[model samples]
Target: MDLDQLRTFDRIVREQSFTKAAAYLNITQATASMRIRALEQLLGVTLFQRGRTVTLTDQGMTFLPFARRIIGTVQEGREALRRVERGRIAIASLRSLVSPLITEPLLRFQQHYPGVDVVVNEGRQAQIVAMLHERDVEMGILCWPNIDPLLVDLVPLVIMRERVPLVVAPEIAARLPARPSIEEVLALVPRVISLRWWQAEPETAAALVRLAKTSVELPTGPARRLAIKGEGLGFFVNSAVADDIEAGRLVEIAPPDFEALHRDTAMVVRSLAALDRDMLADFIAEIARECAKVGIILDNRLASLGDKVA
Candidate 1:
């Protein structure tokens, strides 16, 4: 019936256990049970089917969306008040983009707004989206073509597209002929260290897999390292390995028959009205400037938004 009970119900649905939800909320199991019972009584319907594992009843399923909306609205109200009282900005970003895309822009933002407090959380795409929905962060930085229904209500403040190049160590590049075909490169070094950090097309991903005699899945950091060590060829966003390529640590290989690949990263927000317009504009400008330094170009109409905010 109350926010606490609704929160408890939502947490239980997420955690799939009353005991776990209680622990997460830092409340006693008995108290959690009492709140749920109170809520069920108020609603005149059994919400959850009690069992070894928590399963939502038909009525609970019907109420879940409403519960989430109420929670989100309350959270938004709290966030708006907090923003007015204190200069606080929070964002979630993909781990791979943190170093290349987020760090420099954040430093520039701090220089401009020294009194403002900034919090950055790093996670995968899905986790970042969940954080946005839960109102845990005001904005998120992630790869584009998300296709998640949850993003329908959000706005993309900035979108940057960067080329994805095939790279390998200097020594590995030396062993290959000029303008080598993908098959020719794979013949010399059959292993391909793959990182799916970008939202590549399904057919493109499958094609890359098929080309590699030994396809190894790795996180961004490790995949870059392996490619630097000449263990395998790597497909990476240009910004990620730009310094390495410039320093002669990694060399980009252009296969004549291979398709040109690009990945788009976006800065998304729940609503523009909840943000400090001037501050957000400055932050966006800083990000665009930094990305351009690494050859990542703004691919969307956010430049006009930035101008309007300015």
Candidate 2:
């Protein structure tokens, strides 16, 4: 019921092992177990199925978002007070979306507002959305199609569309048909390492599960790393791996009906009325400029890939 118990529970779920979670939180394993037991007794339902490897029960999955919100609330309050005192700005974003999207603009912002303090919190979209709803962050940069209106009324700015293509190492690409169908391509790839966020979509999630035998879920960075090694096929945004594609380290594989996937990237503020209007607008403008640059780079990369295909 207390913050400590909640923190322990969250860490345990993340680490998926009592011992590792305890180490992460700098507590003993017994203490971690005790906290989960206490929390379960208070909730009147078992949160996790205790076994060799910890797995969340149905109840745990239902409670996870609420638990995150509770922690986010406290952190947000502290951040609000910090902002009032020291002119701080907080941003929440997915781990993969941070680079090239927020990094350039953030660095520019720091140089422009040298007096203001910036705090960056990176997590999955769910966690980032919770932080935004709880007011833990002043602004957030996230990819589109994953936005939940129930979480927060997203006031999006600078919506940029970037192409995401299925890519593989040159050797793997060489083995694929000149222009394979979606089913053929899916069948040919020995493994499909999908990013978790992409799997969040209901249709994609179901399709991925259908290929569960050969698919593995990973975060963006690891998925790209594995793809570069030709370990498996990976679907990634052009901006993230344009250099690799251009340098021939990775090859874009276009299916007969590839559908040309594009994701919307946005810069959003918590609320138009709640924050400093001018400051938010200025930051949005800066972020938009950087996003434009990214779009240009992605377009160029895709064009190069097209030239190769032709």
The model with the greatest lDDT is: 1
- How badly does each model clash, as a count of residue pairs? 0, 0
Candidate 1 local lDDT, 172-205, one digit each (tens): 8998898998888888775887787665454665
**Candidate 2 residue-wise lDDT, 270-291, digit = tens:** 5555334345555555666677
Report lDDT per candidate.
0.82, 0.72
For each candidate, what TM-score against the reference? 0.82, 0.67
Query: Candidate 2 deviates by what RMSD?
Result: 8.6
